[model samples]
Target: MTVKSKKYHISGERLEELQQIAEENMFMHASQLNDWRGKLNIFVKGEGVWVEDAKGKKYLDSLGGLWYKAAGYGRKEIADAVYNQMTQIESSPSGSATISQIELAGKIANLYPEKSSRSFFVSGGAEAVETAVKMAKKFSILNGKPGAYKVLSRRYSYHGGTAMAVSLGGAKTADPMGPTMPGAIHVTNWNSYRLPYSGDPVDVAIKCANEFEEVIKHQGPDTVAAIIAEPVSAAFGIQIPPQEYWQRLREIADKYDVLLIADEVITGFGRLGEYFGPMNWGVQPDITTVAKALTSGYAPLGAAIATKKVADAFTGGPEETFTHLITFGGHPSACAAALANLEIFEKEDLVGNSKKMGNYLFEKLLELKKYDIVGDVRGGLGLLAAVEFVADKKEKVAFPASAKLAQKLPKFLFDRNIVTFRAGDIISICPPLSITKNEIDYLVDAIEDSIIHLKKDLNT
Candidate 1:
């Protein structure tokens, strides 16, 4: 399977056109528009775990294109699937369903924690989350609890960029220009690296889980529609909560008759070595939001799968109709792409490989903690892992924002032709699930070299 090995560079007038038209005029996501307005890396090619810039320089994609692309890059099967579906039906009307949509929805429902489930599709992670919250509230209304509209999520969780999703993000990312949607509340989550409450890691996890119950009571249980959280919180860091924490959440939701929503935007589709993350916790959330790796970024797609108990409430009569609709939701081409991606997951055993390589990566990351700049390593499931930097390893004190350690470290890695995502002082090491052992070796070795140089530069 030979890919286009020839070097690709935009050196002539085309480069000028791209820069003048796209780079200068268009803004990037989650980036400072003014600061990076003209200076941007233009990637035009990808193969396996590597991507090539317009300059034809290749770099290891350590974060898998924002934690999607689970099947790696340049998958012809996925491309063919999308193309074939486009020829058949590019899209169906919002009120209508297509063959690909029906098949993919059925696939998702079975892959969810609840076998007897239904899937509602959307275009992105944020939209998927928004759909879940709306469904929760509507289900509450049908279930005779109209006041159950408030959504409770964890602090530092990144649901998405939409209004309701931003509110669920808590103080970390709520939009300042707008008021957070009414009734969206965020509670403390378990960050073992830096315990918000006073206790050991496992104990802190349980306490943090209990805080949801406390907050629900404080906010009035009847007013709280659902408790939404990630099975493994990844915005701040890859913080995997203990089973005790998950158990408590299940208990709390049941006790209060509140719905549980698992935001699997990052953890789903073999990222955590599980086909489904919430199921790995032995808990069945009433609603689970999924995106990112859903179609491996081959196309825009997301879905919220609801358990039968919750889905049954929508009798489709009178006020039971789901009024909201996304124009591109369940587009047949996107569904086709997802179907092909999942086939790759099973055929190549990428999920199994994720666990295998994930273990190997964790072992290597543990070795990195010997360095003063490497404060903590977090990960145990799949290809998800994070390394936190600290000025004082003994005290676990993160470098102040003024240090700009996060900003500087990536530049060092870019020089070494490696790309990984970072959140403040924490570096995320999630690559494509199809990543090889040799690739992991290269990634960790570069990470080590970068750290050694960063430490020396900081000292002076």
Candidate 2:
């Protein structure tokens, strides 16, 4: 369980060159720190749970390439699958009637809870969200509720980065952009730590469901078309709702006749110890959008799976077309990659691993709460968890935005050879489900050491 620092054998000059390349050419995400540019350690290779930087520094990949490398890095089978598919039918687009695309679509459709649901493939998560919104609206119209165009999303949940997805996202950071898509209504999310209601777990769940009903009634249910939610609330620190939330939410959606869209972009395909997050919560969605682990990020592929009821509403003669299409919607190579990825998940018993490892990680993280700087440690029984840092232990005071403490904490770990990041004030650990217990111990040690070091420096 111990991780000794390996010899970083590269010359200092070579390390400087890599740092300069990132500074000069890379366009970082909005969450990335500009000052940390020079501190960036360029990765050169990966195998299993370890990534080696250009400097030959080996780090445990706890973030798993934005939570996509579910099967772990340097998986030879994945590479072979992609290579074989590329050699066979590399360039067929969704626009054409191709066999690879057709077969892959069938494979994806089969993954849905409702076997009758159809799938519309796309390049990535954002595109999937965009397609889901479009489908929800179109389905609403076809069902004779043309005015129902609003999408209700939960606050602090992240959908994706596309305009429509960003609009659908209810996070604080997502709003700075002047104008997002209209009619994207947001309701309070079910994080008990932030909920206004003070009661038992079942009471809180009921209250949250009531809040959704209030939002619907206030907005007029006739005007609302769908309610999109991340079943496990993956982005906002992986907020796991209480037991009855899903059932109650489903009740609310059905009562209002609103299409329930589960955005499983981050929680599907073994991330939540289930095939889909919606299924994990025991609720059925009218439409489901998935990405991330769909192809384990080996290829860019996403799907919007529509339930039979939703599909049947549009199942007329040939004249009733979807009228929606992405040029590379069902790209042959992407489909091949996804099919292979699913096969790997099934063979590896990864879902079982996620459940066991998630429980182990959670138990370990609970020990972290003893540290004064760690305000909260939370997650579920899967390969997802987060530790939130705070300025004051007793008051739970968040570090000021000007200080940007959350960003600094992860960078500190990164510099110390642990790859991870944060969502808002919470630093998350969503390593590939294939990570071993020994790797988990290394990740925990890295964070533990970094926090002690950072706290000492801040006090001084």
Candidate 3:
């Protein structure tokens, strides 16, 4: 809690030099085709829950550095851990495992729902998801159903950017990329805010869940490998499902002999106050994909933690060795950083803090309902949250795409010196689990100011 971001400012000449590099050398991701390269806000340093831009201006990092940073920033322990690991051994081949990888795998397994689960490391979340889907298909093959390679995913949920991950997640990011991966079936995703049908909340939830069973039946369960989804969808408004929903999915998966995968990349490592997000509802998935907080952004790392049942499928015969491989799947330095980051979590009891603060945050968010632009505020899990904007709250109508309501609101918040990102019509508010109430207040206040200004802009 005492950690503070160090002041950082580049000289005018240095700043201009960096701007030139941005305009030419650096190709940004999901950006305006290098149109505004020099206009980028270059963040130079970070510590605790704050980040400093090149101009020496510090802002509270409200999105937890892309929903990781469970232990926050500028931890010397993490840096030292990585340094020591690199000096000892920097990398490992996919076929082989390093001491760090072996140790880290055990530590990761202990945190999973089934403590005896096995971990298969990857570079990050996208790869983790890609790996999970493949694991399910492989399991299907083990069950003598090589034809069962199809995966079922919720329409609005986000998995990652790889072909398989994109295929599993039908979020907006997958739209412009053209066709989804073959055999990926997108199904109905439920949102409590805007029900697709009118009925009792519990009954309606069951109806939505039944839609998946229907998909499995229609697609032929024999041809289906797995049903995949984020325990709580992040990019699509933090869509939280009811207990009944997960229960139904589990039951259907069991009845149909289909594997269940929980894409826990954004919700893992105590993001939802629970060690694993799905634990909130007592749903133990066959495979859990994770990343982001695995190394808390200090090092790129991810893993598919498979339950003993799923892992045992690959343990037979010389040919059954789970043939999937990533060249740099379990880098030693990354494993070391992940181990250290997790140590910080235990030392600080960040998970307990998340539960306490998450409750307080949701209670406070109710106040945003007073504003016309605030249509829905959704989050019950730890730090993950979203505020969906609407032009007509009563009717739950969204601001037109032409208005770019989601885009401009974050810009206004930038002016107020807060850092966050918008996912379509909603703005994410996932700060570090280490965040204090005062920091949350600062973020919410900036959001309020941004909303007020945005309303004015729309009216004008």
How many clashes in each candidate? 0, 0, 0
RMSD of each: 2.1, 3.0, 2.4
The true-versus-predicted C-alpha distance at residue 204 of model 3, in Å, is 1.8
> If ranked by TM-score, best first, what sequence of candidates would result?
1, 3, 2
lDDT tens digits, residue span 270-296, model 1: 888888776567887889889889899
lDDT of 1: 0.85
Q: What is the lDDT of candidate 3?
A: 0.85
Candidate 2, residue 290: lDDT: 84
With a 3 Å backbone cut-off (N, CA, C), the pairs that clash in candidate 1 are: none
lDDT of each model, Cα atoms only?
A: 0.85, 0.80, 0.85
Q: Rank the candidates by lDDT, best first.
A: 1, 3, 2
TM-score of 3: 0.95
Candidate 3 wrong stretches, greater than 4 Å = 1-8, 172-179
The window of 10 residues in a row where model 3 has the poorest summed lDDT is: 1-10
